[model samples]
Target chain A: MSLASRELPSVAATMAPPRSPADTPAGAISGPSWLNNLRAMLAKELLLEWRNLSRLGSVALFGAVTLVLFSFVAPPQAGARRMATAGFLVLALLLSSTLSLSESFRKETHHRALTGLLLVPVAPSAIFIAKAFANFFQLVLLAPVLIPVALVLFSVDLTATSGVSYPLLQLLAVWALASAGLAAPGTLYAAMTSDLRGRDVVLPLLFFPLVVPVLLAAVKATALVLSGDAMGQLGSWNLLLLIFAVVHGTLGTVLFGYAVEES
Target chain B: MRGKFQWEHAVLLLALVLLTVGTYIGLAVAPPERHMGDVQRIMYVHVPTAWIAMLSLTVAFVAAIGSLWSGKHKWDAAVVGSTETGVVLTGLLLSQGMIWARATWGVWWDWDVRLTTSLVMFILFAGVLALRASVDSAERRASWSAVAIIVAYADVPLVYFCVRWWRSLHQVQSTPETVDAAMMLPLRINAFGMLFLATWFIVRRARLELAQRQVEETTLPERRSVEEVQHA
Candidate 1:
């Protein structure tokens, strides 16, 4: 079924004459079908991103340029350069993620699409989850391009150095977990600021301070992995990253309904 | 209302008196530390400011919960007042810390757990105030800020833990056991003085906010009616 037809009953109940017996059953039935509504919303988000591929391309380009600038500013010593690679890479991802988040929510506000989404009968948390997943997916796609460019530009030796191994698997794991940490809060803040003036300026002000733990843990984990101490030194930082992800993800999901309500 | 003002005035006066006595004790009565000498006097202000900063933010956090639970504007005012006070204290703490660090650690800044967490807390609550300012509607601002404060406060422990586990170049937390008894007088006095001053600030600011909100509530409908008459 088309998305509009599926949402019509809920929208109709909200707009139509009050509490007729005929509409009451439809409203009650629709409230319990939030799972299907969530799936449809998630699909719509992905489809939207796929159709507008340029957004993804621009984010990738932004990350690439940031990486280049960082490399130039970095120390020239091979040892020092290797040590700084992970930090620079995470910084690039963070700056690019901020831009993407601002753009995503600005579009929603410009088109008044967020209000329409809120009008759907689905739980508001579903909208948050879907948007977070869309952001996480975009970051995942950018990681391949950004990581390789960073590794080459910084002259990082990813091969096992001394007693530790710097495997590709560990690097990807850290990237994914860190991206999840960033995306959950990023999407929530994007929603919170989208309706306000100077939202672009406000997002970073509110976002960076809150995400310090994430950046700290991610940079630490990436550093450990790159230095070939992945298993030994990474355990606690990994746990911290997991906690950061879970706390933010759960908070964003629960509070998002309240955040976006009556906006 | 007159009685309330009297109590507030009394508290402010007591804080001022204690502050004067505390500075005297901190400068003259307390003996200098053997290691750092007189430069350690900065601790009299620094420690109290740090304590009050954290205490004020904790107050704001509780007020946030109350605002969300009761949906009362008074709680919102409390949050705003305490949060603004906390931000000011945090700024003072950072400045005091920089001076102390310069004397003790020989550096203006260090990435130690306490120092980093203080910086993070300052930025987070300042952001809260900024978020409060950006929104137009009072009700919307209150609810959104309540949620934001809760989220930011929740991250405090995590920031502390991350910084602690990563590495610490600064000394471990100071407790009564570590501090000499002779040094404790000024520290205790200043702590109480800072507490009273912070409470006075919060109470006065909260009253101002509530009065402003009341004015808006009273005038908004009249303004709307005037607009309606114009349209008619």
Candidate 2:
């Protein structure tokens, strides 16, 4: 009874703010408008993320730690070291993405909170967009912390820009695109596997392979950003990253209803 | 969908006979290539398997779309069948490519375009199988697997393009002009043979999935009715 009551207020409160259910008679209103529902859900997602800022901190630390390990694995030679730096940094982002993606849905299992989200009758597309957008922004946030950590560890200075225009901005663009890539599919797969027993293993098994193009494109684009873009080929690689994100994001919106409705 | 004597048997027999003849002719009758010599014979089996692997996944992709739209058992079964067949052939294709690579490149593997794409494709589809294995609810299993298959299939073209951009050490694609006139017969024969063999495997797999589903329904009569109503 207590859990049911708690789940109802936040959902119902969004519908009618001034009047409680007791004051507003049965025929007083229909359910919340679709726009209201989406806004409420998005607000709820961001609010939850805001509440767990500490978790974000830990996840950043995790990404930083992975960066340190990647630096160790790179060869001692200077030329190869620069090449490996971009790949490893994006790889760290990809790996850290799995952590928070899984956690985002795992929280919904508490008192079956996701079931409440569904029972709130939120549109599945709205649900997916909210979840995917939150996850995407989370990945983007990691970039600020991780990029500096990578620069310090790899000892690459931005001021040494040769044939490169706006190195920092280019890196940010690639990071945003890569995060979009991971966020779409990762949120979808995490939604499916989060209800399973071996989710930790299952999520990565599905996610990592699906994002190979993202990893390759992002790594390549990042490499060009770090080094000089002699051939002027960075735009195409960044476009590839954008393509993956857009394709999966659209697909996920269409399919998440099916993946989530039953569970 | 079930009968005493199925079309799969005919396909199986035809595939067997064609494969035997094609292998014999490829081994003894076809003239050896001037460059790779006898080692090039592997292309007969290798190219056919690669073609059929793509076909299998395409079949899976179409079936995935079908399953999602119709929510039918047969579509789900085809998703399982063709995806499993695709994975098996991709594994075989990888090994065959490795043998060919060792003979030519003098290394077990290289980060060439097709080679890396094929390796990633193999892991990608195989991951679909692994995803399927972990889902316990039959309904969720069907939909989720279809979803995964579609999502995975979308990446194939993307992987091809990205890998091409990254690097291309693999040789140029063989066209009719490039391939020797004498080599065409075995290649055609093996390609058809492999196609039939893949069809037979898909039908057999779909039948097995249906049979298992039948056993489940019989065991859980109450749930079967519930599922029927759910579908209805």
lDDT of each: 0.82, 0.86
- Per-chain TM-score of chain A in candidate 1 equals 0.86
For model 1, state the Cα shift of residue B102 in Å. Answer: 0.8
- Candidate 1 lDDT for residue B227: 52
Per-model TM-score versus the true fold: 0.89, 0.91
Off by over 4 Å in 1: A1-32, A161-166, B1-6, B168-177, B221-232
Q: What is the C-alpha RMSD of each candidate to the true structure, in Å?
A: 4.6, 4.7
Compose the digit string of candidate 2's lDDT tens values, residues B10-42. 999999999999988899999888777899899
Worst 10 residues of 1 chain B by lDDT: B168-177
Candidate 1 reaches a DockQ of 0.70
